[model samples]
Target: MTTSSEPRTEPRTEPHTELLRPDGSPVRVLVVDDESSLTELLSMALRYEGWEIRTAADGAGAVAAARAFRPDAVVLDVMLPDMHGLTVLGRLRRELPDVPVLFLTVKDAVEDRIAGLTAGGDDYVTKPFSLEEVVARLRGLIRRSGAAARRSESVLAVGDLTLDEDSHEVARGGDSIHLTATEFELLRYLMRNPRRVLSKAQILDRVWSYDFGGQANVVELYISYLRRKIDAGRSPMIHTRRGAGYLIKPAEAAAA
Candidate 1:
């Protein structure tokens, strides 16, 4: 489980490290936690990524800060003094439904994580997480949200697997597939490359940038994620090359 307190021996770089708001403003992030020390640590890490930070210690304060700061993203704690984290998020969603939120909590149970995500959390970092992972997850969420805001209107298609960059929507054979930010980007890279075998190192470098330390397992994990969503119960488009890399092509294309 990745948490914010995990120590890192080396620095990590994000693909959108220099990302700004659509309006050319610095990206803003609201950090909500009753723990002042934790908030400080999060703020420092986010600031290092060039994002403006707002801190809130309670549910009410979080809601007020969200209204005032209009952060591009939020790092919300599930437990609050005044209210439960989900309640606060429910309120925030009414005001800013499109804002991406990442949850922070000590609950490490599978069901607890599911509950948090089912509550509309874009992602979460459990207790004792590495700040690098937190930053990576945040970058992924913000990148996808920003892409949606920009509405680039770019579309990529490969053997019926289609992704609309502008709308942040993916579909396979008219069946909609909902994917997380990272998953979408990973698919986009695969779709762009089409049947070409892309090594784990290549995928990591291109999709996650060099900051993720070229973790091959991460690549494999996401590939399995994509396979489940886009290929299960359908003609498979993603193929593994054993010791080589992964490739995405139309099922028919592969046969041909």
Candidate 2:
């Protein structure tokens, strides 16, 4: 195993041992990676979130764990020793279609990131990642999943763009817009605050989490992602405010 040159802050030793679901059940998470130490560290941090965690060091073990533990979410490593991460993801999807997955990979290539998401991952975090960021991402995923399950609102709209929280659907001018969990959350935040300039810091805090200590560049990356999917080939609704931040508004409102 190769060691990262990046400085490692000592991982928080104490776990949040009492985390539980709304019904008083523990939030279950399966951590999959060949690196035992990394999995141990992640398990500790996630247990801090009051989640019950099960660990798997290889792809087959990951699938088995997911099936037996019935986790609400999965933190998966891309390069597993026994099988590829996406292969494991495929098996997990077959068993638990709606369970949100966050992919962890060492590569930062665009194609690799796209492939992971295209394969049904809800979010991607590159390695050398902060445990705080992982926890924040998991929190966001679980929160959104819970919201989608419980939301009473039928729809949210800012002009022609519409998002149905209960249905887990989005559309613009009658054209369906497919979105991953993270994209849906980010757009939901923007639509909830239509026309208001949201700094990257604010977006990160709300859409990601206040606990996420990762770089602000991830905000920029996902914003571009939203533009391509939501605004492409149409009158643009997502606007960059240069150094100020970003905003989503009706096209006419932006032109005004």
Candidate 3:
């Protein structure tokens, strides 16, 4: 037997970031689901992975947490107390549209899956989701969003107008447009989901970061802001639907 004369040393593994951010801090995440146990489990798992995590039980809470956390990503459940996941996504698309959302729910119906994606969710992991899979998907979404953020300009263009989320700046052709912080975020969401019809409720929830509790008129005010700077005396790029919602697109205007 060899004599025991060695210092006990714990093996070290290569360092890895749980949440990768250019800021060099762990990425933040929000988990919105009604299942308390699952939410806690996910929270623990994410924390163990070194990512910051927050939880919400209802749609309202989800919206608030998302806005406050400004999470790098969100894990959402479809059946929420106040609203459905689709509605939440609609709101997010209006405010924090580019922030990737990963949906979690027991609803495995194909239609539900399609609906979530159609509403702008980045990915969907049905209930009974594995921790490993959740982590993988979260990483994938964060990576994609981060890459998008780094594009030479976080500016998305259509026709002669461009909306830059990173800089909170808008430009028409070559002229820079000024917008308030909220207005800039709204315009950026619209630009990212170009040509998509977004409802009033969606706009209110996403941009305002909380349900206006029925305030749909805020969209009109901000749209006016965008029009004054981005479309006034120019071709109308942002259009409103009579009974539907608002959409941003190339002037090839259609009912959609």
Give model 3's clash tally: 0
Q: After superposition, how far is residue 255 of candidate 1 from its true place, in Å?
A: 65
Q: Candidate 1's error at 66, in angstroms?
A: 0.6
The TM-score between candidate 3 and the true structure equals 0.51
Best by TM-score: 1
- What residue runs in model 2 are displaced by over 4 Å at the alpha carbon? 1-19, 147-256
TM-score of each: 0.54, 0.53, 0.51
How close is each model in CA RMSD to the real structure? 16.2, 17.7, 17.5
Q: How well is each residue in 84-167 modelled by candidate 2, as lDDT tens digits? A: 999999999999999999999888899999999999999998878788888878878887777222223455566677788788
Over 172-229, each residue of candidate 1 has an lDDT whose tens digit, in order, gives 8889999999999899888756557889988888888775754579998999999999
lDDT of 3 at 225: 83
lDDT of candidate model 1 versus the reference: 0.80
Model 2 scores a TM of: 0.53
Worst lDDT 10-window in candidate 2: 14-23
Report the lDDT tens digits of candidate 3 across residue range 69-99: 7888899888888898889888766668688
Better of 1 and 2 by TM-score: 1
Instruction: Give the distance in Å from residue 74's predicted Cα in candidate 3 to where it truly belongs.
Output: 0.4
lDDT of 1 at 156: 62
